[model samples]
Target: MGGEGENTAVDLTAGDPADVENDNDRIITEEFKIWKKNTPFLYDIVMSHSLEWPSLTVQWLPDVSSLPDKDYETHKLILGTHTEQNEQNYLMIATVNLPKEDTEIDARKYDDERDEVGGFGGVDNKIEISVKLNHEGEVNRARYMPQNPFVIATKGPHADVCVFDVSRHPSVPANNTVRPEHRCTGHTKEGFGLAWNPHKEGGLLSGSEDMVVCYWDLKEAGKTVAATRQWKGHTAIVSDVAWHCSKPTLFGSVGDDKQLLIWDLDEAKDAPVFAVPNAHEREINCLAFAPHSEFLLATGSNDRTVALWDMRNLSQKLHSLEGHRGDVFQVQWCPLDETVLASCSSDRRVHVWDMARIGEEQDEEDREDGPPELLFIHGGHTARVEDFSWNPNMERTIASVSMDNVLQVWQVADNVFNEGNEDEEEPADDDLE
Candidate 1:
């Protein structure tokens, strides 16, 4: 696959070892500058805030705060930390400052009066902790109950999910500690899979490395919550789980077993109602159902590919998206765009895609930019993108957190998705499996 000398040479191994040694620092600085200069061309607005430590997950609070005198809007974030053994880990709430909804939006910039000499590296970003709770262990994952945003749940300390009414504590510093009011315990090992049923109040689902999924009813239970039911069909660790947006009894999961399964609580708990074995060439890391189109599903995997599948036909995938060179960690359908979705990966990139643009004609530049459906590629983070979510309250907005402890909140350029394109029909739903 190597090309000629003009751009050829696969790597640095072609010359004398010492002379060929790559200067990573030099390369990184150069790359950051180039990307920052191009950001304004790609983003409508962007904010890059760094945290005290990297969070394994990030979620937007349902509400946004607007102050009369300020030029920016304030948004609260739900986050969890991963720290060294000797350090204290926490479930945290942080507030970010953003330019008030679209009066004026710009791109990444640089100033000599910065931390790094070439610092567009989170320089203009501002964020601060609003509240922090002492977690029993590193937070594996965190989610706010959909129906009631004030109620939050965190997974950690070996298969336990702690439920907290976050409103109980005032907006205090990280030191003024509060504890979870209830805890759900059952699985034998730790997991990153945790979700709340959107249509059902107090309904929670958690899966673990123990190859089991537990359904917890947190409403009537006391301090220590127990699973009302458990499912045991997965042969390996369950990587992620999701509850259907409109169906209270419907849910889905993907796992290291290379399987995608659909579950209905109204049916037998011991077996999945439908499953697609080998839905991916490698184990699936995460799956999300399209919120607007109930029949469509998106999945990311160790295969470095993102697959779109129609639940009605599991025998083959509708599209196999190829670009990421590393394992994809999270794949989420945007709340505001029915045909749009985003995926984060171990390759240190966050890619936004649009299904409606698939197979479209492209110019030379567009042809070189991966796939036509790959709307945008955010290569801002210096480390693996751990997690990301679309802003529930804004258009084309996304918040992504990374292993480098950076949290970027950016909105795609309106023209990126809307230019010259009329609204197309929502993906056909005649085939809801």
Candidate 2:
């Protein structure tokens, strides 16, 4: 692989100043002002990079210690990509240096400057290192352990999941014979998703096409991999899996069987604590748990919709968000805000939804039973967007990867509805069954 550096600037001006006094310009400017007044949220692409191979998955480093201490900063990210020429897959780690301000500024100050005269200066981004892995099939998912950022776990078209150590060096091995520290093999078919336990170290979860969720313990030193537990609850291929943010023993999985299963490690063997049969009309493709809530969860499905579920009640959904023109591939809850969610789909659009209005009463005339409120729509990718990740340490910052062979990092403005809104009450813990 090769490395290159580029500096790109963002233009946020509503219109040109040269035509500010013309009649036609006045009409256009007025229309633009009206539009801006109606639009609640805005986003600007801060950094973009075109990779040689189509990126399948991208993730921000869990720890921000490597970044500079400043109000606005930059950090590192890892990506998984595949080449059609050699049919080989590789892992890339990059150091992205975003534009920064000289002095500390509040959100209002930043917004005023951005709206008046475009955004901050250019961004400095380049690849730090690229290493080839020993995977013969395409890599579907890659993630870093929350407590152990140096260790990464990857799963894909093969049944086995590979764990690598990046603490030694970021580049390829000097001897060109680098192998994974651990090779976890248990599933009978290709793996589709991988997630690391957030509250515990050395705990990893993998969901596969074989309809099983395998948990691995990498703390064991002598063994290549220690398979501690495996759960078989889905009747079809398991598409995705996610561990609860605050619950150490709780995790959720979605599958082609159109079911969302919640499993607890302390429960009985091979059975879920709760199962939502027919969670969607079509196959469920992805799942994410709210970062701050104990019971809020989100699921994306092939039916071109995203659904919010209150785990306390399994019989009904909290909200159904419909906007994607194609199958929804990924859904993620914002780590900073419990009421915000992000999703991407095969339609090449990345949508951010403000879910605070889910239970609010609407005026009869204004409410035609429309879908959930969309905060922002991002459409820069030329091809299908496969996956995206939110930076846990940053507010409203997200990075998305696509089949267009590009990775884009951007930030969304705060929601307009959040200015003077009161917190919504949580649902009662009454059982829905």
Candidate 3:
């Protein structure tokens, strides 16, 4: 009896393991099951709620209005880029933060009335710049459209980018922001590409679908206006342009003629410093430079391949990445990771590759062993993927835009295999009892 007495345990409650199982089953049924199946992660994240937010195009703008010196929290503005039958561009903007604790109705009510309370949405003043396309096929001029809170980007503050709406202005106030006051006369044809000079303030470049690249110097003279520089090149529609982050006057453009044109804005007549001919097998859609690797440049093309070129030895191709079946749309290198590059294609697939190992000295025989490893294939979109952007501040976050008119933000895990499976519940260790 004495030995057996030591084995005794207390059953202080009416509930047994069966009851525990039943309680958990009810709990999961009522609370966890729906969320576990639909939500992206066990915990809350920006992408946890749903994937219906279509439109791969998004920009992360930090709240610089506060403190002026210290960077505030970043917010993502997601929207679609499409021209409808009414000739109106419709877009939805969603502010991305952590999933909120507020109820759906409460959230809706808050958003609807946010501006009235002088909250984040209350700021009615947005910097507006207008781009005018002329018969000569150039962004003839860009001007600031006057409105309250509309400040011209001159010496200190600068507008991030200049956007064009194919659709004319609507009668509604909400729609008024979408309309251009004066018909921008610059590009002879519709400009396909618009980029702000990362180096020079108010300096912008626009590429025409008609095979011409124009530079615009935006200045303040009563009107928000942009003037074109004499610099012009590319025999075909310039599909993409990339500016050296540090070099203000230096930028490169890729055209349908399968050429890469590099320029120095200061030396307008000197021609491109380096012109890579036949850089792609087909039309090039986009180009990007490694954030750290100045000598490295990446281009995506209609030939379904992305080629990485080493500027030091441009005479030969560095690495030709192949896998995309359809035309490669956009390629972006991770701002921080030298080895990783992300590419999206008309095939509706986003592929990431690690090419740091593909060093210049690697022998052809060794390379025959294999190319860089394919990291992941994201396949959620149903239409041609148009553009994908990487957040400079966030790790493993990428935003992609597609012809489907949806913007998606994907948080790629470094270890895709380690993702938690919320479907199956693990039983507690019996011995612990």
Candidate achieving the largest lDDT: 1
Extract clashing residue pairs from model 2: none
Error of 2 at 11 (Å): 33
For residues 192-300, could you state the per-residue lDDT of candidate 1 as single tens digits? 8898998888999998899888999887779998788898878999999998877789988889999998899888547998899998989899989899987888899
Which residue runs does candidate 2 get wrong by more than 4 Å? 1-41, 65-72, 101-123, 126-136, 175-178, 359-372, 414-433
Q: Which scores better on TM-score, 1 or 2? A: 1
Give a tens-digit lDDT track for model 2, residues 216-293. Answer: 878764436756899989999999999998999999999999999999987767799899999999999999999888
- Please give the range of 10 consecutive residues that has the lowest summed lDDT in model 3: 1-10
- Give the residue spans of candidate 1 off by over 4 A: 1-28, 106-125, 173-178, 363-365, 421-433
Q: Over the stretch 15-111, how does candidate 3's per-residue lDDT look in tens digits?
A: 7888876764464343323322222221112232222323334443322123333222334442432443333333333444321222121111112
**Ranked candidates (lDDT, high to low):** 1, 2, 3
In model 1, the clashing pairs are none
Better by TM-score, candidate 3 or 1 = 1
True-vs-predicted CA distance for residue 162, candidate 1, Å: 1.1
